[model samples]
Target: MLKLSEIQRPIERELTIFEDKFKESMRSSVPLLDRITHYIVKRKGKQMRPMFVFFSAGSCGEINDATHRGAALVELLHTATLVHDDVVDNANVRRGFFSVNALWKNKVAVLVGDFLLAKGMQLSLANDDFGMLKIVSDAVQQIIEGELLQLEKARRMDIDESIYFEVIRQKTASLIASCCACGAASTGADDATVEQMRQFGEKVGMAFQIKDDLFDFGIDDVGKPLGNDIKEKKLTLPLIHALKQVGKPEKQRIINLVKNHNDDSQKVTEVIAFVKANGGMEYASSQMLAYQQEAFNILTHLPDNAYRHGLEQLVRYTTERNK
Candidate 1:
């Protein structure tokens, strides 16, 4: 697999410029808000979302000011969601660093998230980037709906393959879809081309999520603790497939363990073992690969360029990454 750095060579300079612009976008008049936003920027992730935006823009037309604004808008909304998610999950850590909620408390974290969201909208509106704003705004709505749908289904523990797909499509895929759509739209691509990039991004996101699901069953020392999903009583693709393969009694027993004994290490280990024994990991892997292939197929129809190739490598990276 090509390293992300190598894949990034095509738009390396653009990404560098985007960094400064994104930081400027996060600036606030309040001193405390500035401190918190700086912390968020310093511990930023791999810049995967911006890479998607730049790549899609380059492939469709040209990397321009609108593309930069679009990438910044996506990052603002994405970071806001992550901050809110940590508060909702009551998670103290993110990417091995203390989360905003951990250092600043829930009330502060929530306000910070709101501030980031408002800043994103303001930036777009100031520049008349309504197209990009609508794209990201729609994604935000989908993510909220997805989280709510998951919570509703989680209570009943009744997520089937279809429901699972729907949840991920809305929660995870929608954001990536917007990244690609915004990228293309920023480059002044027509509706059809933008839609094509959105479809491609959605497929990659699907594969990316399935890969994350597989990590829970993996024996390797992935950053997150093993069986974290089982502990949280979240039924992912592997557990869902495993449940479908078993007899009613066995299925109920496993579900009971997940629902009640999820905190028990031994029981969680047993559930992981059951998922592996029933070919859950294999089924999920196959499904992930299928989505990856679908993403590649979409890329083939687009203009052949270094940027398109970069997008292909990014899809591979998401599925192939260890953590």
Candidate 2:
């Protein structure tokens, strides 16, 4: 697999410029807000979403000011969601550091999330980037719906393969889809091209999420402990598929462990073994690869260039990452 640094070569300069602009966009008059936003800027992730935005824009047409704003808009929305999500999940850590809610409080974190969301909307509106804003806004709506849907289904522990896909599609894939669509729209691409890139991003996001699901079964040394999802009563792809393949009594027993004994290490291990015994890992891996191939196929129709090549490598990175 190509290192992210190597894959980033094409958009190195653009990313630097975006980093500065994104920081400036987070600035606020209030000292407390500034401090919180500064913390957020410092603990940023691998810049994957911005990379998607830049690469998609570069592939479609010239990278312009609109593209930069679009990238910032997406980043702002993503950061806001992460902040709110930490609050909802009652999580104290993120990316190995104390989350905003941990350092401050849930109230502060929620307000900060709202501020970032407003900033994103204002940035787009001030610059007349309505199309790009709409793309990301729609994604935000889908993300919320997905979360609510998951919560509802999780309480019953009744998610099937189809519901699982719908949850992931809205929860995880929609944001990346917005990234690609916003990127293309920023470059003045027509609706059809924008839609094409959106589908490409959705496919990659699907594969990316399945890979994450696999990590819960100890498929790789992903640094995190195993069965975190099971503990949360989150029925992921591998477990869902495995449940379908088992007899009713066996399925009920496993579900009981997940629902009532999830905190027990031995029971969690037993569930993981059951999933593996049922070929759940293999089934999920094949599904992930299928989505990856679909993403690559979408890229084939775009103009062959460094940007497109970078997007291809990025897709591979997401699906193949070790940690």
Q: Which candidate wins on lDDT?
A: 2
Model 1 alpha-carbon drift over 4 Å, by segment: 220-225
Cα lDDT tens digits, model 1, 53-170, are 9999998999999999999999999999999999999999999999999999999999999999999999999999999999999999999999999999999999999999999999
> After superposition on all CA atoms, what RMSD does each candidate show versus the true structure?
1.3, 1.3
**Alpha-carbon lDDT of model 2:** 0.96
Clashing pairs in 1: none
- Candidate 2 is scored at a TM of 0.98
TM-score between model 1 and native: 0.98
- The digit string of per-residue lDDT tens for model 2 on 34-145 reads 9999999999999999999999999999999999999999999999999999999999999999999999999999999999999999999999999998899999999999
lDDT of each: 0.95, 0.96
Q: List the residue pairs that clash in candidate 2.
A: none
Error of 1 at 228 (Å): 0.6
